[model samples]
Target: MRVPHDDGPPPPPRPPKGRKRPGERAAEAGASDMSQEPGRAALSPTVAGGEAGESLSLRPQSLAEYVGQAALKRKLEVFVRAARGRDEPLDHTLLHGPPGLGKTTMAHILAHELGVRLHLTSGPAIEHKGVLAGHLTALGPRDVLFIDEIHRLAPTVEESLYSAMEDGRIDLPVGEGTRARTIGFELAPFTLIGATTRTALLSGPLRDRFQIIEAIEFYGDDELAAIVCRTASILGVPVSGAAALEIGRRSRGTPRIANRLIRRVRDFAQVRGARSIELADATAALLELGIDSEGLDMLDRRLLTMIVENFRGGPVGVEALGASLGEPRDTLESVVEPFLLQRGFLLRTSRGRVATMKAARHLGLELPPGWQGALDL
Candidate 1:
């Protein structure tokens, strides 16, 4: 099965020609960027309209706003200061870790700290080497190229980046069919900020080219609580510390998840005419949405079920498991499957996906009766 394209989901509805959609008003959560392209607009992160939601200006406006990543934050501060002091672009940096842990946040933050212009693009958007070369040649000195999901880059496009990164040059092909002249275009010194959730899948040659690689880990419950409360304050949602903590604990350690839950709770609060979101209100809201207390969503549980029942306490191929669930195989492969595999909750075997013994017992299902002879129950 092929990796999914950014075409992972359907595009959000565009405004009716020139008319705005209902429920989007000034100061509303969805009104983050009124001037954004009509096809995709998200007030909060997560893909709202096929494209990754959240705009450049919508990224946290300042480092104080970036929150968490204390150690990385300190190191990056020094790095940015040194580069800015010398008036040079920052080193080509890589941000890696689970999704929504602020990899993109750091990319934007770095650009903001350097006080330089930032140009945004992504790995998948550059389908061919020429298209990428076009963007590279356009970069100005001290500019930042922010590429999200860097691991998804096409191999040729990835190769093209090497010369540009190493020597501030983009080699372009002038003609086709073997008589092509290669022209080296000089690019102004620029910073390449790459963000990826699947760093392990990145090739050694690609990974080795980065000067600084920082992995963003899951925020602690307290950090998430602070993020939820801070975000609510920004959106003008009246939330208490308890309310904030409740939402944060169930957020699966992702700020994107915390911000999303806050929006949902705000809607509930407004509909019920409640004063604000409380612990109980937040719990009831999340339960209604099928996000369990432990942050397991419907798909999370379904993954366990498929491994336990269909795979028969043994390994099974990913494509077959994806087919069983009727999920887009690419979505399963890229977004959903990684977290499960990382938590030791699921095992990837040479044959396929296997349910860890811990996973089987957590779901309260009986182990296969016949498997007792082959392995301990």
Candidate 2:
């Protein structure tokens, strides 16, 4: 479908020829723009290393190329079609869920499907109001400003975005006393796409600003297998269906992890002088990486072992768990805990975290005598 680039026709001539626009003037004055942050030339979904770095090339450019999230895709397809029919910008959208379930990919896909330029920034990157202003004013109508880790936005900077999201304008406070008038700068009607791992950290007002809020769920094994195979094809590595499924099983239901594991497995196959990746190659690679058959990595095993040994199979608070493991609370909650909780390896109760019998069995350790009945709750 031919997506609308801008909101209808261009505005009639407002500024004379050769005159700089407000945004251009701001740029000329060397205003700090977070969108121009170093190493942000591309909306890379992963860090620079191994398969993570290679994911940039594999990132889906359009909705058609995206994988998984069937429900989200169906709704988004209808929404995009409707929005396109009206020649309007998509409503501000907030995508919240655990990391690496394709939030960033979905953001890029939305902008691509809208046929608009995507402005990328992270909440921590927008340190000051000038940075936010610069980004807001620079956008043409219907452009997408994607902010990752939206929950980390500073209160002041986040407040600065309120008017921009609601009224399509920003109030710039200038001067003092008698001349302390706030100048309202009109912004083009653009879409703000905010992604966050912890939506609860966002202030209610900030959260409410988004017209569409959706949580991305983890992909099933079949979906992850498809993702692995597609990524293998993109990386020019031939992968057997069994090998792909094996890698997917150990991906912890995340596309990023699946792609990363596939690459590592492919490397192992190459080093072993194997012609193509197979189930054995994937198993060996994962074993070498300290990822067990149940997709439990070093940290995951550490957490489980710590709970079993130290906490007596756990009823431990996340803070206490983090303190014991020397890992950050955020890391424990967002990274390690999500997969464990999803896999039924761990449970969070009113008291604290409790490891299940399955987790103990995975480690080849017997659970505490009463633990099985306790886990039923």
Which digits, one per residue and each the tens of the lDDT, describe model 2 over residues 197-308?
9988999999988889999999899999999999888776778999898889899999989977887787677657666687888888999999988899999999988888
- Model number with the top lDDT: 2
lDDT of 1 by residue, 1-377 (tens): 87767856867879877676566654454455643535442233333432223333335866777778889888888999999999999999999987788877777778888888788888899999888887887888898999898899998888889998998888878898888898888899999999987877798998999999988887777888998887776665668899898888878778888888887887666556566677877888888888876677899889878878776766777788788888887778766766666555677767777777666776777777664212423
Q: Number of clashing pairs, model 1?
A: 2
Off by over 4 Å in 1: 1-58, 176-179, 312-315, 341-344, 348-362, 368-377
Worst 10 residues of 2 by lDDT: 39-48
Each prediction's TM-score against the native?
0.78, 0.84
Error of 2 at 83 (Å): 0.8
lDDT of each: 0.78, 0.86
User: What TM-score should be assigned to candidate 1?
Assistant: 0.78
